[model samples]
Target: MKVIFIRHSEPDYSMLDKAQNPQAYVEFGRDLAPLTARGRLLAQEAAQNPLLDEAEVIISSSITRALETAFYMARHRAINLLVEPFFHEWRPDLDGLNYTEVELALAHQTYMVNDGNLPSDSPIRYETGAEVKARFLLALKKYCQYETVAVVTHGMLMRQFVPLDHIDYCQFVTCDIDL
Candidate 1:
């Protein structure tokens, strides 16, 4: 089977100041935030790809950003869609920190870290990098039972699995594997 994994578009904080913590989203709740105006336009451009024109099924992470990105593509192709929480962004606990603090916290971690094994005492529910990889592999195996599937999820999720040097803000990669 053929599967296409597409990372979601740029987030509002993509342009935030260095002091801001962009990785704060590791601890986000299940709120469905709409795309920024530019994000919407980027989604449009991503949807126009010729390969996407042939997509058979569209699946997305339950998170708002990923869902919104998938919705845009579905609208363009007039396809039915499915939301899978297994594909949701990695959720972590970051309690008490205001928005600004979270952003700053993440900036330091993002470049210094490739993966995380959250501490056992973490207050919030967090998935280890290993857990994230395993879940994604499971979802991919389950979804590939169909002929062709398109998955829209967070860029970090994609990076954990696929090695893209310049990770596309909203980009698609195709691969076939037995696992």
Candidate 2:
């Protein structure tokens, strides 16, 4: 099987600075953030890549940004887009607490140090990196029947499953799956 992973397009983060409560801002942004105009064009351009033309199925995280990117690929290929919550981004904090970008980076570092072992007193309720990998692998197994599958997801999630040095917005990489 072949699995092509596509990162969602650029999100508009300008509104994040204006919110009074950072946690609320993040929660709302997670659900509502849309792509910038350039992001839309990027997605459209990405859809034209020859690799996607062979996609037999397209799946995407339910997040709006991912869905938007998936829409372009699905429309270009004339395939129905399947929504999968399991493909959502990794959440380090379960309480919907506000975490700045710097803090999130630190948390990832901590998680790596712990080998994805959640500390007993961890403030954020999120799947560890190991857990994310396990779930993503399981989801791929369930979809293994497809000859070519395009999965639209977030950068963090893709990193957990594959060795991606960097993933630009609307960028995609194809990997061969033994299954």
Candidate 3:
């Protein structure tokens, strides 16, 4: 089987900051961030790839950005679109409060230094690359019947399992997998 891992287009993160309920945004509303106009247009353009034409199934992260991108990718195609949480972004463990980019970067630094593990009493642990890859592999097993599968997900999560220097918006990496 062939798995096409595509990163979602640029998301309008400013929406999260503008949200009335920042607490809710920190919790789950973060997943509701939509793609920017440029992102939407670029995603539509990327969907024109002939490689996507061979996809028998289109799987997307439950996040809004990915789902919207999936719709564009599907276009008028008759392929089935499946929303799965396992394909979601690499969510970091954050306090239920608003945060700045610098704070997030510091937390990430701490997470990396600890090797994704912290003291049992510590409240600063994050998911490791290994953990992310495991879940992604399991998700693939669920749809082994499909010959070609297109997954629209976040770039961070893709880096966990994909060996690439960088993954830009709407970038796709194809891998042949035996299931």
TM-score versus the correct structure, for each prediction: 0.73, 0.82, 0.84
Which segments of model 2 are wrong by more than 4 Å? Answer: 19-22, 27-29, 95-105, 112-125
Query: Which parts of model 1 have CA positions greater than 4 angstroms off?
Result: 13-26, 94-100, 103-126
**Best-to-worst ranking by TM-score:** 3, 2, 1
Q: Which of candidates 2 and 3 reaches a greater lDDT?
A: 2
**Structural RMSD, model 2:** 2.8
What is the alpha-carbon RMSD of candidate 1 to the true structure? 5.2
lDDT for each residue of candidate 2 in 74-152, tens digit (9 for 90 to 100): 9988997899888888876656666766666777777767766788887655668788877777777878678889999
lDDT accuracy of residue 93 in candidate 1: 35
Q: State, as a TM-score between 0 and 1, how close model 2 is to the true structure.
A: 0.82
Candidate 1 residue-wise lDDT, 1-179, digit = tens: 77688988766543433325544433352234567889989998888888886678889998878888888899998887899888977544335443344553553364225345664554333456677778888877767558778889876577676776556767888866567
Supply the global lDDT for candidate 1. Answer: 0.70
Alpha-carbon lDDT, every model: 0.70, 0.80, 0.78
Summed backbone clashes in each candidate are 4, 2, 0
